[model samples]
Target: MVLPAVGDVDRMKRRIQSPDYRDWRKKVEDIYGCLHPVRLTGLWEIADKTSGEVLKSTSGHILAPCGNRRESVCPACSDRYAADAFHLLRAGLSGGSKGIPVEVADKPRLFVTLTAPSFGPVHNRRFTASGKQAPCRCGRYHHERDPLIGQPIDPDGYDYVRHVLWQAHSGKLWNRFTVALRRQLARAAGIPVREFADHARLSYAKVAEFQRRGVIHFHAVIRLDGPHGAVDATPSWGTTELLADAVRAAHAATHVTMKAFTIDGVPVRFTWGDQVDVRPIRAADAHQVEQADGTISDDRIASYVAKYATKGTGKSEAADRPIRSRAQIELLRTTEHHKQIMRTAWDLGAPVVCPDCHPDGPHRVDGCGCARIDHCATCDNGGYIPGPLDELNLRRWTHMLAFRGHFLSKSRAYSTTFKRLREDRQIWRFEQNLAELGVTADSVTVINHWDMTSVGHRSDEERELAAAIAERTRAARKHRYQTERTD
Candidate 1:
């Protein structure tokens, strides 16, 4: 994928000169300039809902956005997702939009961050209190971009198994933390855990981030409201101080355990690292991000959490898509330490085999009858497949490092949802199109039937052109947004 050089306009000359170029450009613009546009062949019609009289009918080709939220994969759709995330998060924070009450802004709100416990010491670049660069475990003051940073100081001694297992159960750990948080809040109020929900509701929107050490850290906006949720006021006792205390207490109490992995017969446990940070969110002007009194502004917190949703795992240049075979690990562009992590996740997820048939390990052999048979006097069917943390589909999630959680998630009471936001956009689009057709929404219903025709460009020339178009469109959109904000 070497891009064209100098004035290599020749690469895209054909597309730019072709008669279909205008149509192609228009289609790309309609999808907000998607990098990997899906080609669709579809039938679209607007007809009377009651009489079923078709007022408009057409059959043609169209381009749709890929809708990938990862910035590494599709910036166009990623920005779209981030914008939606910002609104959803901000609605819960500042309110006034998305059916949330404006007074919810005064609710007891805290910004919480929870991190992974250390598996082992790793090389890092740290700073002293006065801002001097501190020495790493390797006894060196590493540069910020040093390639060796975050790699295990003792590669062999580093607990790769513990790290991988923790990663796989991180989502479960977060779920447990929320439950514990509710319990802690209730205990602080001297109320039973079961009756806690009747007194107050806990709502949060959290996003997962991958630190340089290749583990997930969650940043969340926690708000306390009455039993009915955002619209209802929090009880008189639900103060920001109390909410922060409960969050810290919950972080301290939450731990998840897995089956024994060693001959010692002791269970492996996972818990959050000691770096729990809880900051109060203050109401301020949209321009204020961090207030003078050490509180974070609502606008900044929403923007901060939304960006993480587009992130990839850690500093590794690993595959964005799933890996089909173990051999692909060697081809990854990340550091050897990340490679080891991926390798551990892959191997630990392998099926257990009979000691007699494949004593060397469960590495499947060609034409082997053992893997196919159960209780065949050979392989014992692998005993439900010993996946990492018993997550049977760990192999399927190798690209994600076995963390099977949504990057951005929220409780039911947390304002609006991503689905609802997208549906609203669709409705607005429908209205715009209907107005153009001079049709009333109550009189006609639009129907769309589409099948995939193809995906992506057929040549490097088309890809380069599409990339250019995407950049231009994105810049224009940014300019428009900025202009509107100024106005």
Candidate 2:
């Protein structure tokens, strides 16, 4: 697309007709003769930095991204993200990428699921070990494909207020849980809590997800490592069995006590629900084993976690405001179990001052009503609820309060640090860049100049040229594909 440019062209025209134009015109002609036509080419040059000597250079066809989004949206970049994630997880688990040893997998490995306690009963797919389906509490024999599986089993008894509060505080609760878990592990191993660090370290990657009920649960890949991380050897006593036991003990012992809420002159305290499942990660066996009822290996775990990475609190009426509009909120509110949560969130957002909780500082991040993220101590408006918001669909996650974290996030020492992996990627990119420039050896030195400019679509003439080139390229590809197919 050619931009309409009158000023520059007009200035040049005026200069052409000036009184001293004859001499000036001769100089302009000389310069214009030297100007190169914009014949497109992929080109590069490299030179010795100090001596200004040419060392190496190379270039070839460059394919710019189309910026599409249809899964089709830049398949190159999307595949890159998926591949990187695969390598990242594979590196932490089996230690393949980089120099991480396979021995790391032999350490105390656990694929665990930690759930939110019940605020109220939400509808769930219920079946016995023999696959006998049970009736839903809603007094209906729901079908196998019922969409209400994650909704409140009993809407009136559900506690949406508590659920949202838990979501808000989920991060803090996880931190506390980790601390308690370390203590439990040390106690199980007969080591002092302080000495536990000396024996082994806890490495984990966890991803949080919102259930159909609109509450978050955590799926974590937890491992035990030596003090130095995956590279070091864990103590002799550190076994998967011991780790499993410790996890159970930790879960059983863990509790968070909030100030009592007075309901009709009675005080109430809330804690984690009784449902906790701690399992041992058995030795790796590729063989497929069938249970009495057929359920294949959990293939969707990665996709499940990946799905939540793009979700927002607004999806469950978990955010103060919907990301879209009030109409969207209305849709979510009218959904089976999200209405009560939406109403409660709106009601909570109305009052400037918290009824029970006080401001440790200004109630929001800057002028935005959202809480300040980095400097958290500045706000005491933790969004604590006086009573659990009774809404079954919103009940299970009463602990979270209303925020969600990414699944499979980790601290620096947990497995390999993301920083280190990123460094590896950077090194790989640099190597590719050098290779592209035809640099022969690692010892070779090179320098390159890059002239950055924004180029808009050219005039009709240029567009026609580009279209012709594209047509030729497509025809060439079709010919090549036909040849391959025949061969």
Candidate 3:
């Protein structure tokens, strides 16, 4: 033990005295000392764009990219992403950021939730209209944090096939729903769908969340705008009531049929579950006076959606990363229901014999002398082809339980984009750096060539040190925020 301690002390001293130590420390500090830094080896050259004079040149060392958006992968990066998402969402609701007019806040806004259709009965928490906690039908009152809440009452009876398929096609379903919503708005306005865009526009920012039952649900901030989008005022005909009516009509009418596949000779269809909830988003001042009915506050809605934006599947579901092999699937930490759903995805995504190509016969060689010699005329490629269900690419999304949609999305006019926000931050930082360096150049161009050297911490000690620094930084930020709130 003494020898090891001495060795560590000597190593630390050597590291501290190294020429690259300061540069490494600065890079780490720039990233708030990410716990898992991605190492890179490259060069950066900054020069005057007009004069073609080199301002600075340096070799790139270890750098870290925003590791991931999932908190499970990197809490620091996810927190940053979540903060950006919050601002983006809040700007659309409260306005006053990213060029959106402050008056847009008072526009007709709604907090809408679109849920997956019920594939089968599952354990769930219930509450009465009076806010009384009600016991489930299983004759047992579950705790608030019950892990079994979303599990099927009868696991074997659950419709895992449709559940995974719905998850896989959820993105398409949402597209169809949006089109229907616009059509409904048009109908309510007594205009054609094509002409509706000329009269008014619909803008929304939506985030996908996994339900307790390991299915995808959507939470959105929907706003109606004028024909020119957020920059223009909404038409007088567009009202909160009208938007609400159109939302209901759209939900009731919207349905997406999968690309016509027969499973066990029965045609399978997909549609949103009957349970749909849409509520008006009241302003902050109105929140205090609004009855505690189902209505949600704008701030609360933005925060809620942002909270889900940083999350992967809920803690109760499969792992955040992709499930690559059978071994990984077998070792997954999810419940049996989720496992069955994953298995269904894999089974459906597996390649199968093309029915049309090999009808009434086993697969044969090309010696049959068919008219289409290059490829099979029926399947258009080969006798063994991807199954119809496989066309959805379910296998690639097994970790998401077959859901491949983006976690967060928005209409073009909803608000500023994440990319824009990040770019603005980078520009601000660069300008600040230039000021500190006392550089008085009119404009500077930077050319960088970087290649990944390695990823992750060099050792457990480095990882622990980075994590400690990150924790301290987070704690300091929290304290400052609290102080500001108190003030």
Q: Rank by lDDT, descending?
A: 1, 3, 2
lDDT of 1 by residue, 1-487 (tens): 9976775456467678999989888888887767788999989999989999888786898888998887667777887888898999999999999999898888999888899988889989889899888888789888888888778888898888888888888999999999999998999998999999899999999989887777788999999999999988898889999999989989999998776464257788889999998999988465666667768988778888887766642122456889888999889888888888889888877766555545555556674545554464543454334433454477887777767788889999989999999899989988887888798888898888999989886677777777777788779988997788731
The weakest ten consecutive residues by lDDT in model 2 span 30-39
- Each model's backbone clash number: 0, 40, 1
Q: Highest TM-score among the candidates is held by which one?
A: 1
lDDT of residue 34 for candidate 3: 76
78 Cα displacement, candidate 3 (Å) = 0.6
Tell me the lDDT of model 2 at 228.
Answer: 82
**Cα error, candidate 3, residue 394 (Å):** 0.4
Question: Residue 477 in model 2: shift from native, Å?
Answer: 20
Each prediction's RMSD over C-alphas, in Å, is 4.5, 13.4, 4.4
Residue 91 displacement (Å), model 3: 1.4
lDDT of 2 at 29: 32
Weakest 10 consecutive residues of candidate 3 by summed lDDT:
364-373
**TM-score comparison, 1 vs 2, better candidate:** 1
For candidate 3, what is the lDDT? 0.79
How far does residue 190 in candidate 2 sit from its true spot (Å)?
Answer: 1.9
- How well does each candidate superpose onto the true structure, as a TM-score? 0.90, 0.61, 0.87
